[model samples]
Target: MEKTKYSLGYRNSYVLQQYRCLLSIFTGFIILLFISNTAFALATNPGAVCSNGFSQGSLTNADYTNLVSAVNTNNYVNILGNAGGSIPLQVKMTTVESSTNTVKSNFGVITTAGTSAINIQRTFPNISAYTDIIFDFRNALTSQPIYLTNVALSAFDIDYANSNGNTFDDFVEITGVTQAGSTISGTLQPITGSNIVFGQPPQGLQGLFTRTASDPNCTAKNLGTQCQGSVQFSQPVASVKVRYTNTGYLNSATNQEIDLRVDNYCYVPQYIFTGTVFDDNGGITAAQANATNDDITSSGSIYTNKPNYFNGVFNSPQESGISGSTVKLVNCANTATTYATQIVNTGSPIGQYQFSVPIATFNNNTNICLIEEYSGTAYPIRTTSDNKNTGFTTTTYLYSNNDFGRVIAANAALVLKKAQYINNCPNTLNYTDPSLNTANNGDPKTGFSTGSISNMTPGQCIAYRITATNRANIGINNFVMKDILQKQGVNGATVTSVLTNPPLSTTDYTISENPAIGVNGEIKTKSLTLTSRSKRDFYFNTKYGTTVDTQ
Candidate 1:
């Protein structure tokens, strides 16, 4: 009994151990899955930092020294030479690495140079769209790699303004540096002060060195032993001024100077524009529809209502996006000169488009316009919000949501009706006037009816009452009606002259008379503007020539 109990206890213990091992494996799988999903999600959320690295290729220390002298003489110099016109570079220092060093090319070095602290300022184009600036840094003393203690690096946005003055009030500081190619592990400290020195003649800077230095693994023997690691700005900056200070090591007599070497500088540029195009078919209020211009401006809200069969402003979901449309970016003052063109997106989030221009392209342009070309079957345009200002003086960089709107055309129709009347006259020997038994006074108010008439005699007076009606829901402009007063038969009466009276005071219209090719009378109504479901009546009296008999 004791042996059986022992075997059962051992087997239970073994099963319990297996369960724990399985649980450990399952937990690790869950952790890996979570990590992978997070990475996948972040793939679409791109970092704002630009990927292009600024290399100080083949530049010697003498070259940088000469450049600094020139900058001091001229107050500023361009480090990029002539890439983006004339951006100012205040001062810089350079150190060439070994030819085989893959991690760094030529490094921008900042040293004490007989001072306990040093401030280095560098200027470039706008970097407002970026969130961080990353670069590699290392420590050395008189061109020899040596790990230094109590070192701190602080960055300031020189161009940024605060309530105190033009300089940024706060700055980001980095300490506790590690070797290069390794993850930067340090304590980030914030410093606050006034009148931060950033330009030439660096002096009187304020900051504390709290970072502990780690010995770097040296690889480049020709450039001396050095440890390196990267540092990233905690906040977005523009026209930066970096200050390096050390309190642990100070031996100017022995030429044991502490220098901070920096390379692989990067920041994002603001030169992209994005927007979407959609069809405008959602209904609007009667007041909005009747307004002179129904287009919604950029400052206006998105209109939302029932779908209108005729025309309306743009509404999302109710009116879908128009895919495959052509959008072009052109000069606002001169549309003939096109800068960029793209087709509206056809995939998910349809009708979206984007434009990415180079810094030089953006710098050269001032006022720009985004225009969507009309397609063969496209509806009429309803709204536009595509113009933008990209001047050098303007601070706005990244543009988005410059949308357009369009709607279907309105239905329209017109109808016309004509009638004639005869003059009152007694019957002659061989001819009888049609007005013998009828009350034909040649007065339009009493004699003219809304139908045709026959059995007319020569030298009789006739009148015509023509009516035109608009049968659409919209107004019609430039409505014209014409009539020739001679018939084709041999017995047909020929009109000699047409007399017209003033149109009714309720109606607005005009009349004109002219001779036909072979007839003596032709009457036409001047261009008339008609409202929706409106009608107008035109009247004229014609005197017939004595050339035919009664029929």
Candidate 2:
């Protein structure tokens, strides 16, 4: 009776096999029956898996196949049809200004390698109106730190299938990044399995995802909100302000110079098939050398003499295109075990290239040093100033507090201000400071104050402003004011000096406005008078005019 129930009730097939495995794991067989019932109820009818533009499947492309082939196989694809099928790859360069106001090179590149393949599979079920497609980057080399400088732009052709030809308006145009490479594989892994967390949909995809701006009330106040709406609600003008830690160069040197920027546009997809090999147990089959060899074999021994027999095919123009470029290949093992010089003209016209310090041929060139921004507290992104330190530019970015000298930093500002002062000021009038002090505490007796100056270039203008306090209130009958100018550490006797006259009476200095005076404002010299508390503040101004000769 048990055998009859097992055989008759659940026909032994792939679905049955999975159910039996679930039943075996459960102590109470009743729960297994309930679970199976739920799965069956939730499962869409064979033709109804895709409705209203929703798809559920793995992402990735493990072969070098077009979007059409990938879609028919029921795999995820990023379908991008060429506006015109001339060249599938594109590259562009732009100039961008850095924070220091220096202009540097920015690069952008685009290709229909992986994204189209995934979109094709997603849109295959409806050959009419294409819906939202997912790009699986789980199996991609995303772990590698990529300093992405260029933004990706892409679109699709939905009506291509119905019109029997590609058209501009057939597919919805959406800009995004899939796999950043020349050739894409045909196998894709689900993001859930690959541990990739889904982030907020990009700017352009908000409309497709049915999303509105975060702040409706801020519409009038924010320029970004208005600007974002202008570009199809996708290409926000402030997209440049969007920052992602995951994107851009990782482990970059403190002040490493990235002279060449490469722009990238890519499409990747995954496909499913049924045969002797189970889907879970299958692995990627490499593309053969020729089209004739594009067939499955029991022994898997089909071989074509093409250069890309086992390796992925590079469909780029310009033979041996990237002759001088190089790429580092790594595996999940996290080892720098392999490196390959890029093959030129095999995939893209301007292939990948590596940069290094230009070789020096002249003698005494050892003194010529190159400055690199270093990681440190003073100049967090300041130049490292390299001569022959680390040989490799591939090191990670590191910084410390000691990277910048506080003394140098503090002194730099002073020097700059002094230079500005000298350039803007002229020495034509007289000035005074006394107390026989080179430090310029000021000639209190003479009412002149002068500050010590260093690194003063010849012909540089110097000036001084002096202020006097309590001159009339002081009981001391005699007071002297003097100014001294001399080279630091020089003989004081030889230094030039100036002096002001002594007070003849109690009202030696006059004030237009005094705040220290009391309401009983008699001439109270014996007691605390306004003149006793009176203070003076002076400022110096030396505008360039005719020069004066000091004899």
State the lDDT of candidate 2 residue by residue for 1-551, as single tens digits.
Answer: 99998877676576788887877777467777675344222111121121221222211233213332443244433322231211122111112222332222211121232221212212121112222232222211112222221222212111111122311112122233423423211111121111111123332212111122221221111111111111111111111111111111111111111101111222211111000100010112222212222222225533212222112122223112212212322221322332222222224323332212212221212222112222234312111112212222212111111111111121111010111122323233223233322343433222333434455454333343433332111121233322233332246332222211121123432322211211111111112222221333222332222223232
Model 2: residue 502 alpha-carbon error in angstroms: 6.1
Candidate 1: stretches off by over 4 Å: 1-268, 283-313, 376-393, 409-551
Winning candidate number (TM-score): 1
lDDT by residue (tens digit), candidate 1, 365-460: 677778787563655534443444433333444566666665444311345655566664322211123442233344333455544456667656
Against the unseen true structure, what C-alpha lDDT does each candidate score? Answer: 0.40, 0.23
At residue 419, give the lDDT of candidate 2: 10
TM-score of model 2 (CA atoms)? 0.17
With a 3 Å backbone cut-off (N, CA, C), the pairs that clash in candidate 1 are 176-211, 179-228, 180-228, 180-229
**RMSD of each candidate relative to the true structure:** 24.1, 31.5
Top lDDT model: 1
Residue 499, model 2: lDDT of 15
- TM-score for each predicted model, relative to the true structure: 0.32, 0.17
